[model samples]
Target chain A: MLENKDLLGIKNLSPFEILSIIHTAEKMKLRINNKKLRENTLENYNMVTLFYENSTRTKMSFTMAGKYTGARVTDLGVATSSVNKGESLVDTGVTLDQMGFDIMVIRHSMTGTANLLARNVNASVINAGDGINEHPTQALLDLFTIYEKKKNFKDLKVAIIGDIAHSRVARSNIFGLKKLGAEVVVCGPATLIDKNIECLGAKVTTDLKEALKDADVVMGLRIQLERQKGGLFPDLREYSQIFGVNKDLMKYAKEDAILLHPGPVNRGVELSTDIIDGEQSLINEQVKNGVAVRMAIIDLLIERRKKDEVTNTKWSASESFIQDRWEKRYTG
Target chain B: MAAAKGGFTTICCMPNTNPVVDNEILVEYIKMKAEREAVVNVLPIGSITKGQKGEELSNIGLMAQAGICAISEDGKSVENAGLLKKAMKYASMFNLPVFSHCEDMSLVGGGVMNAGEMAQRIGMKGISADSEEVIVARDIILARSTGVKLHICHISTEGSVQLIREAKLRGEKVTAEVCPHHFSLTDEAVEGYDANTKMNPPLRAKKDVESIKKALKDNIIEIIATDHAPHHIDEKNCEYDKAAFGIVGLETALALGITHLVEEDIISPLELIEKMSTNPAKLLGIDKGSLEVGKVADITIVDPNEEYLIDANSFVSKSKNTPFNGHKVKGKVKYTIVAGKIVVDNGELMD
Candidate 1:
């Protein structure tokens, strides 16, 4: 059973919790392969996808997963909803909770928006993305992809490249991968690297070549071009030349290094175009696994909630029964 | 109700109220309400901006004439430096100090807690201490250029304490205040994502807490003010980021000092009173905070030996949002005397 009511971040999850999600995803992936993924496992329940930020892939993936599980899914359009009418995120969440929504899938541009929603609502909260804080579902899918390829995470060297500071994908991956015994090395331009990234139990480096040496899995983060005016980096040309992943630089890897990127990839900026379509690329597979992982998560959380209700009813009924007996004894 | 219950003889109310004490009428109305209903003296503070919008200046001279003790844009920092300088100049002419909430909004970004290892661990957006320091440095320069009496509110970072110390050394007319939370708690308290731990200039690092205590002891931070903000249940009983910033501090400030500062030998009891009472009274030019033959009697007597758990449910204030709830604390207020009238006698209001 999943012990947590919400999937807020990867940092709070134990190795056991991470493994449970991965193990469940593996079973769900097989069902998808055989066209047996769609089921009535979650009938009569309502799930809402509240995307405060624009997302195409993650939002669609979550909707598909909910539909396949037989749950009533409502995707709240932020621009068209009360959110644009100045309703606070918490108020929107509470309104959904009162409407009997069983789960909330939220994506917001603020770091702690998911954390805030989880506290205010009675329904389970699954964070899609929250500012530069965490994207836990994305990390879980990445983990499932890595585990499918490598079969084990112990002593696996993983290289995370490009904009390390603003990428919530990098932050979640570092925590989840490291918790599962992977040695994470984050390589980027000095300005793009956070000062406290090393304290997250990851090795920080400026040289991409050194980071790729003997790497089992390589992840590239999307470089936000808008950050240039804010002095996050000098320019894209300088960034691509130094940090870009080309075949020539890939020679430092162990000949079996797999490349992963949380797209939409800056084709020539973060990685070479050929590498994205290369035999070693797991980017497409990561997207395919994303659906299965999300199904596993929702299934687990819904099951836990049902069990808790049963336990609560049993205890409360027993208390009433004992009280009734005491009252009858006194009256007689 | 809270100030009196906490054994305070007088309180300087911040300008960030619902209507916002930005005009002369609101300032006068606050004073009138306090006089009619309050057991303790209430000194209303006027806003530096109209509606605290940071766009235009408030009627500072008129509000000063209406008996406002000071002017501030407390909840948010004045983003415009030129406007802040002008406000300080006008405030200086009236001899009213400007209480600045020093913060650079761009630097703070979307951070919810201190930008440090803890923020990294939890994957929360970290508000770097640089955000506070940049504004502290800027406001001090403005104070020096305008020659105004400037007081920095809620000093939370070590960098801020250092800047204030260096500014004082350079003979800038600047003073600073530290909240009890800044001196006692660190950003680690936010690990649980508790709404009570959520406050503006959110709880900083352990080193920052250490620096604040040392600064208080060294007299770099001259006062201890609660910044005692209160919000309704619906406002604070939510997620850390969704919750309003601030804890109800009026009732817990003295107990925190007695427990953390006095018992730990960080400051003597008398020095604690100086920061909490004497220094603040002197800064506001109030004729209280001491026992003198010719002065108005504003005194708080406490049983420093008493130990009790901080129960927010028992607080006189309507808001029960405080991270210090259930915390073991020393000292209990026994009596509060205002103008030689025992308002709070033996922990009960005398009416």
Candidate 2:
């Protein structure tokens, strides 16, 4: 395994690492799309996922992603385990790591819980979502899905429109997209969008027409009502009326552009149902590529897991360059 | 041709209420509810800890969550050092000002009364003001260490106000608050053994009250929070040793502020209004404490000169025990608009 490997959410990743993960995901996507890859490329490897919160898409994507990689994926379902029995989260991470997990994909409900978990685990850590903190791979796959279709991130004007206030996805994408040289416009009502994201070099705009004009991608974020402690919103209906991306707003974007949602979309509340299902929507491709990107993450982690295996294993010239970077990262 | 009515609205409500809003959801809910039913914007305080157990962290994505623009621990102090640091580190993330109740239960040992001469005279044990002071120190240190926004709630002592004022001068995001009772009453008010006067940090001495009053005039104490705790009669009617602490303050807050802080020549009328209506909103990082357009239509209209007597039985909230019962005071919320919708109009519930 690559020693000291960690994914504390994609926000902590730089542009090059994100590009590498995306390149790997792109290759995996081509294989999966062409129906030529059924090898379970990571058959003998082991991945342990420890989920400490409720998730629909992240859990399923990580699960299928590992299965597609040919790894022996053991799901450490936390609902009935010792984690629920007053066992601190640190002990749980140590338990999974000591049990020889090649990689650890974890989603926690507490902030910094994943970083805390990373310190305890021996395996590579991938944070799914730590409360509203950050979701690294989700951001990775999102960028991957976009870059795959667009072929580049430089100079792309993407508008992330929706609950920027409660979204870790928005935060990670702001970092990943900006690092890749994309100018992002974060849009929503004043209360729904975090204005400080402008510090990350994204322009903050409340005017939908202004934000969507000439945008290469209109990425809509979900309003996280489940995480609402009381109700930060005056009303979701009112929020939808003001900030939700509708067909009218979509008319302002680039003609060949796409609608991106880190799914579980709140139809008509954040984006119109028809637009989400429209041909311009890359929402499903995001989900499909979610597994592939996760597979890429797991494979990269496991490749670092193997010490001398890659020496005898032949890799392309570009991959050898990646290997050299990994060696420098480890030695440095 | 334009229709003209020369009048404004006011609201007298505490940002620290149940479901301790320390995140966007609670803030938006207040705004939504206020906009739909109330007449002005309803600014709420996000709880310092996610659910007020003071353990988990709340979402600091930003303070843009409608009604909740600020955070507070309500009646509890942050006990965990690491958690307090974490709370401070994420201070800039949500960009919220945090208010603390300023009592270290560990040091205070849950002493029901203030540690003072009155508690000794009544032969009932009291908590040392140091118990509250120590936590203030700890919180200040935490703020200095992590650069998080910090405000002391109910600065009932001279030491605490001095500390806050000094911290402010030193460029810390430090601010403070005093209650209507802290300057209006002393532990002597507890002489009748009234359980309603009993509170967590407890009431303090005359010198402390004077300090708070001076702090108010000096602008060291920026807001006059009501503490606005509501509890059923059964919870506060028993013996001092058995009854629960905390007296409901919602309806009485603005009146008490007008009576003690404004009418007594201690503070100016506009300054009192700013303290009650504006500075608290500022402390909590919201737009409610003002009259700015493109702003959430939250406006509170009040009769600052109106005279009224406090009655425990007729409060908007469902609690009756109050220390201010029978006290005469000026200032009343003529109307409370959450967002152009009137929740309370002419002392009537519009919803």
Instruction: Work out the iRMS of candidate 1.
Output: 9.9
Candidate 2 lDDT tens digits, A28-83 = 77656766666777887788888888888899889888887788888887998996
Candidate 1 local lDDT, B47-141, one digit each (tens): 99998899899999999999999999998898999999999998999999999998888998777889899988776778899999999999999
What lDDT tens digits, residue by residue, belong to model 2 across residues B1-351? 000000123333334566666677666776677667653334556665777777797665544445455566776777887887787777656676667778777666535667565653333445677777888888888888877778787877778877887888888878787877788888887754556778866888888889889889998888877766666654554335556778766567677887887888989988987887688666655556677777767666778888877755455566666777668888777766655766566856564
Report how far off residue B142 is in candidate 1 (Å): 4.2
The CAPRI category of model 2 is incorrect
TM-score of each: 0.89, 0.50
lDDT of 1 at A256: 92
Best by lDDT, which number?
Answer: 1
Specify the highest-DockQ model's number: 1
Clash pairs (backbone) in predicted model 1: none
TM-score of the first chain in candidate 1 relative to the native first chain? 0.93
